[model samples]
Target: MSSNNNSRTLLVIALVAVVVAGTVPATVAGQAERTGGTVVVEEGETVDSLEAFGGTVIVEGTVTGDVSAVAGDVRIEGDVEGNLEAVGGSVTIAGTVQGDVEAAGGSVTITEDGVVGGTTSIGAGTVVVDGTLEGDAEIGAETIQLGESASIAGDLRYGGNLQGNTDAVAGDIEQDSSVGVDLAPTIQPIASWLFAAYALVLNLVLGAALLALFPRFSDGVADRVSSAPARSGLAGLGVLVGVPILLIALAITVIGIPFSIVGAFAFVLVVWIGIVYGRFAIGAWLLSLVGVGSRWLALLVGLVIGAALGLIPIVGGLLNLLVLLLGIGALAVGLYSHWRTARRREREPRRGVGPDGPTTD
Candidate 1:
């Protein structure tokens, strides 16, 4: 079969895999899993789905289902029947996509030979389109370039410094400078307020859940933060500065790619958890000062206050960062302390009276 035919077949297989995986639980039957490596779908090859966590993902065949990559570069030179989603680094499409293309990265580029049958949405530092898009294009970037050969059958909506050839054809061109503007008056005050409210609510919910699941651990983290504020903040600052450097160093080795990916994900998870804990700590402290002691109430109050502060112009960002660092650092210290306690227990001799005599077991 030709490469195109193979690509289509692979795409179908990928879709089937997704459907099957979704309907059937993995515990029932062990499912195939791939992680932390470059994925190359060579010419005439096909895959159910292509997912890469950190390393590069190159497709030269066909993908029946979705193609997704995080903290990695994705290059498509074949065909995708389903959606293409990428985050971080860059995305280059020089093939055919039968579904929508959504990318958030440093840069996104569609070569002249590229073709998209569905909508294209890209959020990046730079976006260059020199291909054919049958559907609408929504682009948010610092810079957007449309080559002369570009042809868009649907509307083009972009926000950024846009430069394109007059010959580039599209259904309509709409430029909205507010598309990528951040922390500016691009959006209405009401919308910004609503967003802040939403974030506050979400954090409160997460904080409540964490407190319910791990009350002792949560309390311990908060206590650590209160006891050693400066130390925790310093630790957090170190992590904030050191993690990216570590990731870069790991990426230098082919064998370390998977580890780098895992570390990156772990770092993000830690930061999120730390932020939640920080808010919880703040709420608890405020409640203590007022002689009220409900964890739930504290979470609610803290989240509200934090969200409101975040709505402030410049000081809000710094305050949030400080909270994040303090939380992360406290959590780290608490873990280390726990580890030490466990080690001490393991090393200490246990005295017990046996049936015959005193013994250590």
Candidate 2:
């Protein structure tokens, strides 16, 4: 496919993913009021910014906070205090931003006068930065067009195999990133290695124990990750954002006692979910090993070998991602399994519940 066609395809996929994953709708196009074919956030508008608006957003106003739009044609003509994350058909930065701009679209542009204090990243066809990117500009695209006025304070990294105009990068060149490296420098390699190794070892031990004493628990966890990603994701997000807020609110009101208690329990559930995911990954690996060799040695040999390989530096990060992906998948599957089992056994139970409303088994 042509580069434009490829970019358009990815853009559509990303738009769908954002909507499904976040599920929060926002009509922020009216931020600066409408004018002509553009939806402008005109000057002198101080606000909470916007989120998930599906229309074109043309901003010429002042935003005190972050602005995020899903599937909007994002055009920034104002100043924003916080970051801007946009997934749209097209993105254009015509003003200034005090923070980063993360955009994914068919095409992106930053005009000569546009200024960004932080990074500006794009995943699309062509990124013409005829503006100033005070921080780095990372792009994954078919071509990068650098105008004569373009300047970047940091390195410019590209995903597609292509060179740029000499004037495209008016900054010092950094190390060229490669696909074989899997963008390891973006994250801590040591941390990834440790996480992968830990996941392998811990899951192996848990899987072996489950196979020996409680095969049902192993089965339960795996089913949850695979079939109940929504619940897991919601549950995970709750642990990260909701729990802390719930606790603070608990201290504020005596009437909110129940909510605080629930938050505490939810925190525990998140940890349990993590454990369940780990064991499931280990179990899958064990099965793979047994399929290839001896069943008796699968429990011990699978973990030792898998984990040992995880400590191998460059390969470890990808291994860690694979383990995590499996664990998350397993959690969904495990949840579904648990739910079906519960419903099967309780077909004729009492309607008005009493501690029987899907208690953690």
lDDT of 1 at 110: 93
Per-model CA lDDT versus the true structure: 0.75, 0.59
TM-score list, all predictions: 0.53, 0.39
lDDT of 1 at 332: 83
- Stretches of candidate 1 above 4 Å error? 1-146, 150-164, 167-202, 247-256, 310-314, 354-361
Per-residue lDDT tens digits for candidate 2, residues 146-245, read: 7778878877776664454555565665434442133223322433443455455444444454454445565555445445645655554444566578
- Stretches of candidate 2 above 4 Å error? 1-39, 161-171, 174-361
Error of 1 at 110 (Å): 9.4
Clashing pairs in 1: 11-64, 14-48
